[model samples]
Target: MGNGGAKFKFLSFSGKFRVLHLTWLAFFVSFLVWFNHAPLLLVIQEQLALNDQQVKTLLILNVALTIPARILVGMLVDSYGPRLIYSILLLITGGLCFFFSLATSFEALALARFLLGFAGAGFVIGIRMISEWFPARQLGLAEGIYKGLGNIGSAMAAVSLPVLALWFGGDDGWRYATGITGIIAIVYAGIYYIGVRDTPAGSTYFKPNKSGGLEVTSKLDFVLYLLINIPMYGALALLAWKVEQLELISFNVLLGIWAALVLLYLFQCRKIYSVNTDVFQGAVNRLQRYKFKQVMILSLAYAATFGSELAVVSMLPMFFKTTFAVPVALAGVLGACFAAVDMASCPSGGWISDRFGRKRSLAVLLAGAALGFALLSTITSEWPIAIAVAAMMGSSFFLGSAAGCVFAMVPLIRRSLTGQIAGIVGAYGNIGAVMFLTVFSFVETSTFFMVIGATIAVAAAAAMLLDEPADTMIEVLPDGTVQSVAMH
Candidate 1:
């Protein structure tokens, strides 16, 4: 059999299967740590005597640092390798979690939670890790499983943390719930470092020519890459504005953060040009060059898909409780369907891309997600509660599948820069969430759903702009010989 036709043996204890299991477990724990406070936030708030605004600030801070951290982590993953980066991230995240559990003041809790956002960067690491172990033909399914199964960590956090807090049954019970996740992460960090390899034996691990930022193929792409970076920093600026508006930080502090972000953006642009400076010199070969628009388009797609998923899942329980007059527990269960459905939807989305086509599959799923959200916009008290939930579940399936389809294409875009590309895409997902949630602050629930639908429609158009993956991509082997890896 050709190397491209790799069949994943899920039951196997060795080879790529072992790598897949290990990497996804690492990702799961990262997410588990990342969202550990979410379910127990109420208890944490009560114990700490936090007001509503302070609670909101914690949520914002949780994701605020993650946007920029993903970009930095992406570069690190490409420059180093997933095995090392993942271990270090876990160790750092564990320490932050421990710090958070010991917090007495709001300042300490906020700082720890903000820094813990780095754990979310673990997802991009697995994208690079799995892409290394799996061949092109199986890339989508493998990545889908990594992303999908790992996402279950968020749900697990929601379900287990609260229960653990109750079981511990005290004012500081939430701390124990949060702290235990740290111990688990620290233990597993060592296991992952010991067990995982960057790549299988004899396979060359590819690195970017320049590690500062992404390398673009054309002048237009360079311009586009710079323009695309605005939203990432802009989202952070928006967070600062929100916190300032809340009076959580001094106005001058907010201004300083804004200034710092501007300087960082300029520095990043300088790095981008420096890294890809040789592109204009005709130093890059045509066969090895990949379009940067592919990155931009996929980033937008992820912003709408996974980004919308993040926004919706955050608000779904409250939406269900108020609209349907359901009990909180029932609403929680109903809302969870959006995330719970990822198990099948993500893999199915990837498998469809593998079987049929990537661009077409994403476009179809995005369009379906649009329809799902559009349907959600019209639901009201007059609508049957069951039917409304079913619509939400249906939309979730589309959105989840579209998210899977986005990753399906991420690995194929440029293999060596898969981590960086995943970083950009993943950051956009967070950007989308921040924007959607910000919009949710003013808009009604139904309107929020409609806005997401509109976003997905635009992303569908962008998906059409993507050039389908060619049958083969050229990669350099360790001995300097080139090989054409199968794309399908």
Candidate 2:
């Protein structure tokens, strides 16, 4: 827990610590509102008379818009600063929660959930704000604390929302429960706006030179950037296909969605070109150059780590119940241990990255995650349940740690591009979930675990190619003054 030269204080309410507290709280409220619907799905379905297919569609729609929303929000965070963007996001998404609560029809619920996915994008906002406040040496721990604690919002919603609903008592209890979270978000939006600044006094907040797409230093990187965007669009198309499989949409409608995706891809490519036209002209200075492969490798590693976490969390309870013959309630509690470990494991991973070398820490953690999953694949009916649970927890620790390590390196790559970098990496996490869950649909639990293990192993090898971030990065201030920002 090195805090550059300053003593690290967890309870302090001044300096960077205050900003960290406020920012993570903002993120916490966003996630709380984002997932408030999940635990109440049963009540929602019953009250709205939703069929099984409609319920599943609501689930899919909840995460559907997050991928693009993160990218769009990241660009805005970089352009306008996190303070304003975060406040507004919380304000608007909070209102959407109210709309979701009041929905009297299936279509209204679907639309509200889809729009509420934008709340997931709030994670990217704090990455930039924290990076601006903390020095490179302490960034991993700061970010780990921010994300690790903030992430608990989902777990909190799962635990508390049901209780709150019960306490409210009645058919509309779930609605009141959901609406309370929205009220909290709306209130917090105001607190966050008045409580925090984007950076410390006398520090500069750097903005990207171009707006529409990520800036690339080389023509090769320019091409790589375009190629990397294909999977994001593909993931959205996959969601549409899944909806169609549920007979929620017509085949013709699915084709229309795919066609629109292709067009959006082309439009994004044009934006990428516009942002990096300087690369084509050979005008980017050598010192100013960074390898886009860093972004690519981090994205792949994140997809494997966080992606598997999302997929596993959704299915682990069912796997436990069926494979081990555990009671439903017990299986769910046991399964939640996977996500519950994030509080400690995420910060430990970031602390390890800070104490050791970033590349080595990430590669080893990813490799460990692969091995952990491989061990998980060996679970069977005859095996002791305690051992199985231990294996799952062990695997969860590695997966969470690897995720922390991935973001630990994100802000270091390019200061001005941190938001976009975090956005792309964060979006890949959702893409990975979509891909792995799709695989699970066609395979057994053992096979699903094996696939994730194998994918992470490949990412571990790729992690070897990542260049260590430099000791200092150069950024241009709005005053046309070149400044050096410390990394370590």
Candidate 3:
């Protein structure tokens, strides 16, 4: 009970569900702040006198740090626990948003944007918190609702923030509008810290076997782990290079960034070795061993699935404006449809995963997504608007379903290391987005969709290779006591 980390017993369904509502709302609020700039950037750009390259730089910086931030925050959540980490993250992001609002120049705005990327990492914390409260059977639906509903904030921001900027009026109105969002973030962080508990009563919380490293069962796993990490850091390096191309970061800073990336990769490799040392010693027992190939496959699947969705959502509105020759506002509204249905379909994906088989449902979802995106690539200016809209929505439906399917397997992968696993997988999703978007910067719209379609097909193939979930996964409680948790 000391330090306000109290363990309370869950006596009522109302209490547990209330926790779910509050936790998801916190996530919702974080996302709202995270994406508040996207819709209002047009206004900010004109007001600040920023050119196209500068604006693109801001966008790149906005997501540049998220890849590593997710991994670092994942470790912090697993070590210090989510209750404290999530609250602090909210507060820090709020402060950064406030800084972003007051920026007077492109450089200051870019710095704030890069720092603000950390908000995207907040999703990893809730994965652990939600897993603690809900049983395995319901975890998918719970996580789906949490992520799917929370994701709506971006769409909502796109719809409302423009109008909010107008309402404030005058030259500096955009700043005030963004400031209000920051204030909401600060207020909610305090509320969450006071209101939430990390775990339900009469339950043992699981922690990773070691701190500061991801445990692997074999030497090959250690090597595969290091190989998989390259892209995550590389994504950041790519962002830095993009910024340099836009003149956001100077040439010297770019070289420094490249050097830092090499060092970080080396450090990561050392950690992988540290975590897998027991496996090399032949001290890992059968109960403690898990297939690392599963982790690698899921990471690749997530990169293509969720990553493509992130990249597509960022560019689809612009594509519609150019291809369909529509008003920017209308194009944005049409693009919003891609994410809008997720609020419903994600929960449906989770419910379906729970009722049917986990692996089978995920495979079906991935297959559907690949086909949907491929169909979407066939759309052109010659097509009717209705048909195009339907195609895009279909693509998002399958993508959202696949997102639900991925997290449906996240908690089931390794019960104790759920946060770290979710973090790595989530980082791959951002890495996918960055890599795909970087590709989009060079390719045409039709080609962009085709590239994404091909990526999804690859992920679908990986989904076919994934092992099915079983009845249970093993975890060790704090007292060094092992327990078997249901995977249904």
Candidate 4:
């Protein structure tokens, strides 16, 4: 396989580029609907008369289910193919958005927002879709472009939703604006279904050998995979603890939730073992194995990068309003500056990974992200607001790029398992958000930024241990024929 290709023409909406455009737009709609309430959160709080604790709980609930949803969606996309799975996901997200927009009580709103977390899993679908359409040499840039443009949905909500609420000219204007996102999601679901195929003509879309859990090649990896799953459930437990702290749930209820989480973990371990029973029996071949360590390192990196992005973006508009005493609309625009840079920076990270090497690009970008967050931590109310915004945009550049770098390697790990691998990595991103947001609930804004910087710095060091992906991966056809897929 060659490491060169024709220059990408992103504007041309023909061939694979057409799939790229449509697929990314689907992801964009998912994010837009997922976060429509964020910039307008204060408005919702005022209209519904929510307390501070309830407001913070909304942020936690927004990302809590995404951890498990990504894992489940990953398995489904791998089994059914991205085309069908993504369409169904968007349709479901649209309904959830409508439900959220019509919420008449905090309980209803909380339930809607928690259900909306599934939309975040839409990202995993596109990772597999893009990997099918684009080759490895261009995979990084392609994935970067997909995620970069798609992620603009959150920034768009930040910048537009506030203005949109004002335009609608009523206390319920926020509802109208949010409902519009739902309509867009539903309309696009049909368009995405018709506009894209799972793979190009005459190409095969590979499926995992088994379903329910990610397959591991070795016994040690099986154990590591099980151990790695603990944090996901632990993150859920953390959320339950936070709810208990809010006094919404009793201590006894919290204990029950924790107990259920333990049982869930044990059940998942059983499914994982069933999926990779061959590993225990010593029947898996060497060439068929990929390192589970790659998944672990990428998961950690994503938790810091994308995870921080989720936590920060969710809270940033409010952060600016309170810290610098800016108006809501202006604060939203400033908060958007954090995610706006994704358009350029994400692709830049992917291009860097493509031109250089994946391991090197991720490590360097993560290091830069740590430094960026460190600079952000120094911001105080005394500082000029413009400087704070500059520091935030600078930090976002590194964070978004690091996210691009993380997904760039996900598909290359195992072609057939791309969706599940992307799911695990993507789930960790939410896990990071849950952990960081939980921290934010307890600490001051500066402390929150400082904690993220420290976590990301540690992930940067671990990135060095990542082994570069090999030139090819072997997969089995349904007919039992062995096919060697080229990575580059």
Using lDDT as the measure, which candidate wins? 2
Please write out the lDDT profile of model 1 over residues 1-488, one tens digit for every residue: 01334566777768788888999999999999999999888888889999999999999899988898888899999889999999999998998988999999999999998999899889999999988888766878888998899998888898899899889988888999999999989999999999989988877777776778887877788899999999999999999999999998899999999999999999999989998887778757788778888999999999998888898888998988998899999998998888888778998898888877899999999999999999999999889888987888889899989999999888888777888999999999999999999999999998998999999999999999999988787865546677776654
Give a tens-digit lDDT track for model 3, residues 46-143.
Answer: 98999999888878888888888888888888877788888998899899888999999888998898898899999999888888777777777888
204 Cα displacement, candidate 1 (Å): 0.4
Which prediction has more favorable TM-score, 2 or 4? 2
Q: Is candidate 1 or 3 superior in TM-score? A: 1
Ordered by lDDT, highest first, the candidates read 2, 4, 1, 3
Candidates ranked, most accurate by TM-score first: 2, 1, 3, 4
Best by TM-score: 2
Q: Can you tell me which runs of candidate 1 are displaced by over 4 Å?
A: 1-6, 476-483
- Per-residue accuracy of model 4 over 309-336 as CA lDDT, tens digit each: 9789878989999999989989878877
- In model 1, the worst 10-residue window by lDDT is 1-10
Runs with alpha carbons beyond 4 Å of true place in candidate 3: 1-13, 250-252
Task: Please provide, for model 2 over 58-134, each residue's C-alpha lDDT reduced to its tens digit, 9 standing for 90 to 100.
Answer: 98998999999989999999999999999999999999989998999999999999999999999999999988888
Each candidate's TM vs. the true structure? 0.96, 0.98, 0.94, 0.93
- TM-score quality measure for candidate 3: 0.94
Q: What is the Å distance of residue 317 in model 2 from its true position?
A: 0.6
Tell me the TM-score of model 2: 0.98
Ranking 2 against 4 by lDDT, winner: 2
Candidate 4, lDDT over the whole model: 0.90
